[model samples]
Target: MDDSQKRETQQRLQSCLPQIHEIHSICQTPSITFGVVHNGEVIFKHSIGHRDAQQTLPANDETIYMIGSCSKMFTSAAVGILVDEGKLSWTDPIRKYVPEFDPVDDPRIGQEADIIDCLRHSTGLSPPSMLCLGPGGTILTDEEDLIPLLNVMPAVDGEGKERFNREWIYNNYVVGLVALIVQRVSGQRFADFVRGRILDPLGMRRTAVRRSDLGGDGNVAAPCVKKSNGRFHGLSDESWPCEEYTPLLAATGMRSCLNDMLTWCIAVLDAERSENDSSYQSQVPNNPLKQMTRVRRGYWTRPADDPEFSKDAAYGMGWFRADIPSSMLSAFSGNGFSREKEYRLHLQHILGKGSEAAPFQVVGHTGGMRGSIFSVFTFPETQSAIVTMTNGRDFGDASDFTAQLLIQALFDMKPTLDLASWARTEAQLAGSNYQKHIERPWRENRHLGDLERDPLLYVGDYRSFNGRFTLSIGGVADGWSTNLSVKFNHRNASECPLVFYRKDVYSFYQVDEDKWKIQQIGAREYKQMLLKFQVDEGGNSVEGLWWQWDADTKPAWFENVRNRNSTQKGAPFLVKSYSG
Candidate 1:
């Protein structure tokens, strides 16, 4: 983490990018965004790539990206809002507010997963899946209504995680549901409560859930459009078709630009500073709901996502334990981006422990999507925070990298990565591909003289055998091309191509031995995906076979037939999502 070290790391990161770009060639678009915050101020901000290959736009600090599970922080904060009101308690059985909620697993463990467990993910629950179609099962995204799904999802995984926790369930779905419980008890809609209690008070003007409420998505960053073949379609105007903030308002769906997010971090940092000087409870301007703060004895009492993080400050209602030195007295929270097949991710993290500057519990959270990366750091003791937001999935690991870099820079230490050397390596790789003529750009690769020019077409009603996927062609685009993406029931944006490895089989072919053979090229490097094709009459279309990772789907299937313009349905019922 020194200057020379940071420069070298930067060089390596930059160098590894072209090879990374090759991965994007098949994994769909690549957009890289980066920013840094130090000493509670914006030190640097930059966007490394295009939003799409359209070459029309570039992401900026204000561009909003869905933080995915990072929304859990918001849900957790909402819980704190309720605690501020004294209407809810961390130890209270969720049933106190959500009486209808019943553990579908061991009856003995009923009500054991309390508010803390929900926020810290100790419920001993596993990701759910009952819908039929692919292999393994898919992790239920928070936007997907889950309460009823929880009841119906076969409780095969059982509770009892590594620690005194539940199975590997999607924690945010439940957390959001619990947030709903808070709303119901407090008589305040979750969004309103969060805004009035946390955001508005903290000056997070752009942090909002409703698009209509956020006043027109507001300079939002677009999600990536992965092709059936696993390459980034580059940056496109295509959005997540569904309301970014509806469905349940629990784990995902909220939006805020890097700048606003940074302000939020500063607010949390400042609040910590403010609370220490005066009475912690007396500062509320008007208490529609009470807010409380306490440092739990342990970092994480139930589960351990990774053992090394054992010393983690652990969960405090909604906040996460950051890895920054406790002597620094700070905390951090955020999610990481994963353009994986089943989940919409940004492997978020939080780190905090009072720092000497303000000297109180400081918290930091980070989120990334597509290819952008962002960080929000706050020193609760000083009530000061800094935020950095970027756009790109390739930059998923950049937040931590950038953070370490910024800290080093502020302290005037050696850097960890070198941009010049890194850029050179990337250029070499890109140049090699260009020389080999594999850089098809968009024009040459997609436009195949005619739609039927190729005999092996992948067109059909494809579904995952694991009971987790349902995808069809939307329509034909750019002439010889038909627009294809996952079906609506597939979760998240529903339009993103669900990349399934092994179970995933969408591929391109080149002439070989007088017959077309699987191209054995452009398969995802970091993610999982597959390809397959079928023929109809003399014409051929493509149908992709991918898995829903969120679900336990591994054995997927393909069916029916059409020219990539078909639709399908499944069991009907109403369920709640995690928007609370």
Candidate 2:
């Protein structure tokens, strides 16, 4: 394309800025920062709304927000770097790298597990839910604790291995294990490896793998969670510290701004096209880029949660093949982000379909943490990318809404639905579902008074049979608030605080969904549990605890041990004495 054509396209795109801004407002997001990259340059960048609810701080193109699982791409790329060096192969048995790592107790499954299995989410392991909850589900924040955490996870039932491989199930624990493999093989902290090898090479100074790395000088956006009433509540903290979950860091602990993210996307777009002048190729090899972008596993059916996408949709190494409108792809090419001949050939070679002939084929990833939502889509056919970051969760529809509108405005497409009304209805439904677990009907029927036993009566340590978990009962912020905190295998300071609700029932709201982080807003809110303590005949000593996860009255019980070394009746009983 000539310089004159490029100028005309840029002018046309700039004219759509007003409609794009309106889309941000319509989503009711507290703040959204966006950037578009065309050809090799960042053609457009802007922000909307305040970083804080007080509206004191306006968000800008450089505001840092948690990218969550989007960090998976960087981690996958790091593995690619090692692969390029011949340090590892995608088919290498993970046990060869992280020798101590064994996903499940079943020896046959462990023996067959390889690096590809971790990236593809087909380890034949149990679902992420079973490995990430209660005593088995403690989040491993410290790198040194990874081996011990893996040791305790209940083995995947061997009988179900056949069924597990038949479907693609997302698992963060496996990704965390992948980070451990990277760390063990590279001899560097996972975060440090990514920064030195990936971030620094890309000139992404504002991008980091840990909260502390964001530094004090940058315009870091305050993380915010959306309430049921359509208002956003800014989180008290700015970044999710990587120290909290060392291995999980590879899965979801990166902080980045719009400027750096756009640069990363551009680098990816350029390298995928195999640009001879591209610095991305100079830093990271072509095989890794092709591996990360091409489909690794195809789904049998369209993702139920995202029905809009085609059933042909599938996951690549760390990215996925997303189907967008072909018209949008053409509009991007007209604006100067035209796909080079090399990129078209590469896409065709990997997809096994002439992706260039198809109207819509984009590769990217989406991520969400407690207070942030992030998305990046790079169109290899058009040589363009779109990045949307929002502080409000609102079921992550904020980013989705922004991406759709940006495409329509830039591509001159007509609206097909009442998007505003649709967004409001979806948000309302998600919000209602999120609040269900907290507002149980049982709460209203029960007496909202103090426990029959003195709060101090329950203050002590309770340990599981294998000594993997110990629950510490204590007073919170004076005698007014009662709390229970769990310590995993006597390492990593206690988390998962259970606050007093009514009588013996303690309510704990899980902030970190870890694996199921992308579920609909309502499904997320239901990750609550009610812990009801049982008393002895004297009513002075706590005897057991009942875990009430669902609304059903039936709950799993952990009977308190009367003697430290004695075997207790009931399932996986907890002793009152500390094991260590």
Candidate 3:
């Protein structure tokens, strides 16, 4: 495009900046850095808000932020590189490399599923609760530690035949296993291999696979949480240690800045061009890019009436592929400043009236963690990309919403719905509902009487059926009274005081202040952490316990070990002897 066209596009993008700022303010996001890549170059870039909670340091293009789960594509690229070197095959059985790769409920998955099945998330294994791998949880720091625990992590209950290669369950544990395979087959650490093969080659000097690499970098954005008072607070390193997440680093641990990410996006776009036209030279090779973006599982089919929405939505190796209506120089035929029509008028102001454009293929991925969120959209057909990253994970989908707004403006697509109003309403509802859910248990059970038996009877060490994880119930003094609190494995930081609900069931919310703060910011896991105790025959003693770790799945039962001499430590049982 000529200078006039570039100037028009820049002005149009500039007009959308106010809306971006409005959304960021509405969502209470701490920081955001976004850019648009066109024809293998960054044509537009913008940054808003502060990198720190104090609002002292302004976030810029160079401010580094954690790109959670967005690291999946890099892992996929690494695997593709291995395939290109003939070091591994997509069809090879996962068990061929890791002998302990077995699912407790379905051993056949380990025996039959291949590398592609795992990469495409077709193994029918739900992603395990990250709490299970927390500091004192079952899994250790090393990637290899996941192998033995894999056999105990249950598969989706009803997905029998589909568990092999039919369903898309998005298992991070499996991805970590894939990384381990990369490490073993390539004879190098997964992070080192990715650094040498992908990051260094692309000149992404600011990007690093390990959080420790960014230790002394003062330019890094601090992860933040928006509290109930509508203010952002930065979390300390001890509260949200990125290192404890090492086992799944290949799946979620990656830190990068806007400029480097833009460069990465351009390389992907250039690779797409090179794949189509042999004469076109790409800065990066086409082999891994082609393999990484190839769709392997269908997850969504657009409604027939929604012409502007995504269609045939599917998951590729790590990216999501969809066909969206794209246009150039389209005019707006509507009135008013409401979300529905105003976006179109904004488009018409930029690209004067023209015909509707054809549909274009778009591939992208979203990454989210405790206090960070990211979104990237690559228009392969148009050779353009849009990326947005934010330090605060708020009640709304701020990152994706900002990216979608940009996509609408850049493509000049006709307005089909009011995105801004819809997002705001949804965020409001989610926040309200979450607040209600958090209070419901205490509200409903406040009238119930005390426990039938002494709470000390339930104090013991309980091990899961597979003996992979342990939970210890101990006593905590509250004024003159003592209450029972439970901790997973031996993590004192995760200990929560149990509230008596009924005869044998009790509930507890996250006691860790940082985790509770994260839930306030919409993390939404463990809103109701219930524990049910089993009574032995004749009700003489506590025999077992069941824990509801995930709200969606059935409670996992653990046998009462009563092993006083066990290596794990817990508060001494109070009121030594209990009447039976």
Candidate 4:
């Protein structure tokens, strides 16, 4: 591209900035920073909104925000590096390295599935509620906890299947396991590998595996949650310790700034040249990046009922691919500009997709965790990319919307949809009837006798295969009030008196409100819906406790390991009780 073309593109992109700002404002986002990568350089970059709700500090390009699941792309690249070195293969069985990851019982996908199956999310695994233990109840801190998941195979609608072939399941646990594989093969910590290989080579100085690595600099943007009242509050747990999320570090634990992120995108966009670039020789090979960005999986058919599935999209190793039809672009533009029409024709002529074929291909990913949201996209053929990050929780599709607008603007095409109006509507819907700890009303149809079961029968130590949490029930000083205790992992171990809210429903009010109050499997079911104890033939001894939440969310069962008549801290219990 020549200077005239570059100048024209910049002017068109500049025209879209005001609309971007309007969307950010209407959506009540605390802060947002966006950059446009054209012809191997970030020609247009802008940062808007305040760093915090106080509106005291203005955000800039240097402010670092958590990139969340976009970190998966880095992990996929790391695997590509391994594959390039002949150290691992995408078709290699996961059990080849991690013996604990054997899915032998699942007749359908166990033996046939390989490492690539995980990268493309063909493992048929879904997000497990038990694994989410971090802020916003969506992140995991332990790698060892992943072992128990082998016992529980991926199921569609709660039934084991003969095969899981077509459907896509977005799973973090599988990605976490991939990080472990990287560790086992590379003989180095995952974070160390990413920093030494990916970040250092690309001159991504502002990027780090953990927040503490960057230190307590005010340059790092604080994670903030937007309340229904159009206010923002800082997250209580400011730092996400990397050691706490060893396996998950590759899945979601990346922190970066606009400049570094732009550099990363440029490196990806110019992968062919970078393969021979001496700057990347000693650190990361570009061959891995080339493999990482190529499409490896296909998901063309959208759900029949889903109205949002109008476009065709697929998944690469860690990135997503979408084929944008020129006809659709024409419709979005309302046949407004002759330049846009010409540009659309140019794309059709180059990609061999005329007015009838899909003219453009977009590849990128979106990420979010707690108060941080990020999006990164690059047109491999056009040499254009967009990277945006905001300090807001509900920034899911907002990134895609912004990227689309910018892409359309680059071509000088007018957008048909009202993005600002859509964002405002989303904000209103998010704030609509915001309530804390939503639970269902008690079912009064149960017999009173059944409700008055022997409290002693429920007092025992129940355990799951994960061993992350232990459910313990013990008698109180009065022997009347049931004492409930939960030892979850090494970090959270607490006990409290069980407040009987309904028949077989107990609430541990002692748990932090933020952790439990915000934990909802569904719109109606809250965390207060404790285990419904399963009884034996005579209904005397308890066998197990089934979590009776909606099957669509928060589904797990704990079998009674021991029925100790007394809640002793030692002997059969073999676990420390929470003193508090």
Candidate 5:
């Protein structure tokens, strides 16, 4: 590296070191590794922090962090490899592979959601996590896969279309379904398939599906947690779901060291001037998967156009594509996982905290657990990427602030201190006017006359994928709980918990009858009802759209809400019922 570049790196590190060090002062974060690649050469490679705070075991070059949803790219790349070898077709419907396919609330709809729908997250159903784990509940899969999801109904939007297909919301059930497809078609389990297809071939020695595979390597960093006092705390626990969480293996189960992560990033930003045109090749005759980073789906985003509030432009396979000025390569935030969506909250804002698509495009992903935060950055034009993982979660500042400030320092940009101050000020103003925010009227329910008219015919217990939330009339809770239920003995095997976002309005749409199922809760507690109950007249088959409390606010992935001492963390927030 040039001396000038070294100086620049030092300056950037110095600017952010205080905050990061302050975080370390509270509790030493697990090992952190950083790798910088520019112009086809790795300019920087280093590891900082510890693997276990109490043990004082140091993290080194090979220590791995749970990459979580970043594995989507790996999954997609594996699928591409399979497709290249002529094992599966991209357009094939999931049912063609997993015939047990059938969504409950709208038996007609779930069966029809396709494989591409699963990858692009357009399946009508709200993601399984949105319903099963998003609220406080145990995940159904030993490997993190959603079992019997064909049974659960998806959430519907105001227009009655499947809310997930519309918004690209959380839905691991569909994602797991893809894993099933990979297994059935490739003759291998999803984890083995990816490892065999991609990792092993690429020589990703430090990556693995099981945590035990990591051995006693203390190079990995623990999760970072922000205490109520706004101080960051990092604790070490050698045992975690990465080793035990299996059901959604495709979702958030893999762990890898920095060396492997850096190598993976190099392949991603493979913007070689002369990339191979043929398949099975890279820009420098390397793997062609690198070029697949562009937006796969053109122009459209799910649920609606971009959210009125969030400017999410489009979703490409598992990657979120945000249109930014000046940069051709789109950017995306990495995804994550949690068995009990509510176990501990983490608001994932750091991934998108860098430059908002400007002179330099900021595209990266974020992963977190306990308090650890992992980041992967790619500057395609420069063939440069930075991977930072820290186990310490506290630093008087939020993760995004710490990360973006660091990024700005790297780019030599003047990250104004008052940039967030305005929002904080506005927040204070709104807080001062708290009654106004509280005065917003909640949505009222519409009559399900169609279901009511055909009531007796469709009144029996209906089931969907995640265990059914029954619609029984005998004795159902009145507030927020929808008598959504599940029974194994049910004639239709697709019975599982289902929640509705809004049944009344969903009944009016034409996209897919059951796709827009609402959670049973009224609009008061939730933004809208997300699931609904319905019975199939053909064979006493029952179904309903189901949902769990999404609890997460718009941008925060999982807000560690109990930390009230931190003004940002302490601000009062309510958990909304899943109403799509």
Candidate 6:
């Protein structure tokens, strides 16, 4: 591209500022830092909103934000490095490195699943529901405990069957297992390995794999979320800090700045370009970037009528591959700010003119955590990329929408619909629906009245079938009210009062404090856990309780193991005392 084309591109991007600001304001996002990379160089950079909840600190190029699952690319690259060295092969079975990794649900999965199967998400493992942390918002089990828990975990089909190499199920635990393999094989901590091999080499000095490594960096953006009141609130540092994510660090615990991320993107784009050159030999043998970006599984197919049309959308090791239609380019003709009219015109103005309706391939990934989200796109054919990072979550898919808008602008693709309106409407509907879903049980069954047995009978220690989790029910007295609440892993901080829904079922909502502390980060949809008590054969004594935590699969059973001596015959059994 010549100077004239570059100026024109800049002008088009400049025209997008108003729309970007409008979306940011509407979403109530705390901050967004983005950059565009063209021909191996950063062509444009911009930042909006504030880095802090107080709105005193301005976000800029140097403000660091957690990239969340975007760290998967780095982990895959680390594995690729091992492959290049012949230290391990992608075909190697997981049991080879971790002998204890035997899933009892499907012994064949434990015996047959190879590295590629896990990376490609074809291992058939159900998505991990409560594996990362206990109800207290802290790491419960360590590396050793993960293996045994996984042994009894259900498959994607909810039956003890294997889907290995057949279906795609996004399992973060399996990816964490891959990182563990990297640690064991490379003989270095996962964080240390990634920093030395990838971050240092690429000169991403601002990137840190662990929070401890960040060490007094005042420029780091505070994780936050926008509330219904249209205000941003910063989450507590202890909520879900990087340190607590040690076991899954490789999966989702890297913090980086716009400048550093742009550097990383350039490296990936350069690697892809070099691979296409027959005469170009990489200094690093076998080049993991090629393997990481190579499409391995097809996940979706969008028809031509779709606004962001793509015939085939697939997943590689960590990146997603898709094609954008070329015919969506047209001219802009509209006036001022209207959700329907303005967005369409803005999109058209950026797109410029329509040409042949062809499609071009692009690869990237989207990541989210408690209060941060990211979207990255690399147009290998054009040697360009877009990286967007925001320090807010749950309000909407602000980062992703921004990336899509930029992609259309860069490629001169016209607007097929009012994307901004669509995104905002969807977000609002999702939040509203989720609130109703959680309240449905109570709303429907409240008239059924309390349980037949004493509520104290449910008080006890309950353990999961696999013994991976423990729940304790106890009485809490606040002011004049006394109620029974359950706590995960016996942590007092995680306790939530149990409300009677029906005769044998009781419901409780977790993370209420976290919800008030921040604006519902991490959890896109709030849910309530229901517990159903089981009576012994005589129907006089409590035996166990069935827990319905995740609504997707079967409810897990937890045996009540209260000691007989802990409670006297019919008085309120107060095993533990809590003050108001």
Q: Sort the candidates on lDDT, descending order.
A: 3, 6, 4, 2, 5, 1
**How would you encode candidate 5's per-residue C-alpha lDDT over 443-515 as one tens digit per residue?**
2343334332222322333222232322222224547543433322131222334332233212211122112
**lDDT per residue, candidate 6, 1-580, as tens digits?**
8989988887777766777787676556788888898766788899998899888899999888888777788877888778868898878999999888877656778899887777767777665445445443455556666666666666646453466666677777788788889889989888888878888877778887866666685888888866666676776555333543444676777788999888888778767667576685554343335443333233332222224532545667777766654222111001112224424333333232254656677777877766778878887777788888888755566786677667766766664233577456635643444455444534654535554556766777877645556778887666665578877765555666786667766766532443533423122223336677777777667766776555455566676666333332211111222121
User: RMSD for each model, in Å, please?
Assistant: 11.4, 8.8, 6.8, 8.1, 13.3, 7.0
Report residue 297 deviation for candidate 3 (angstroms): 9.1
Per residue, candidate 2 scores C-alpha lDDT tens digits across 194-276 of: 87888887788899776667788747776665554555666544225454465567787788999999888876776656643
lDDT of 4 by residue, 509-547 (tens): 323334332331222334434556667778788875655
Clashes within 3 Å, all models in order? 150, 7, 0, 0, 85, 2
TM-score of each: 0.58, 0.75, 0.84, 0.78, 0.60, 0.84
Q: Ten-residue segment with the worst summed lDDT in candidate 1?
A: 513-522
Model 4 quality (TM-score): 0.78
* Model 5 TM-score relative to the real fold: 0.60
Model 1, residue 259: C-alpha shift (Å): 2.3
TM-score of 1: 0.58
Superposed Cα RMSD, model 5:
13.3
Cα error, residue 519 of model 3, in Å, equals 6.2
Q: Across residues 218-250, which tens digit of lDDT does each residue of candidate 1 receive?
A: 455655433334444433323321233232455
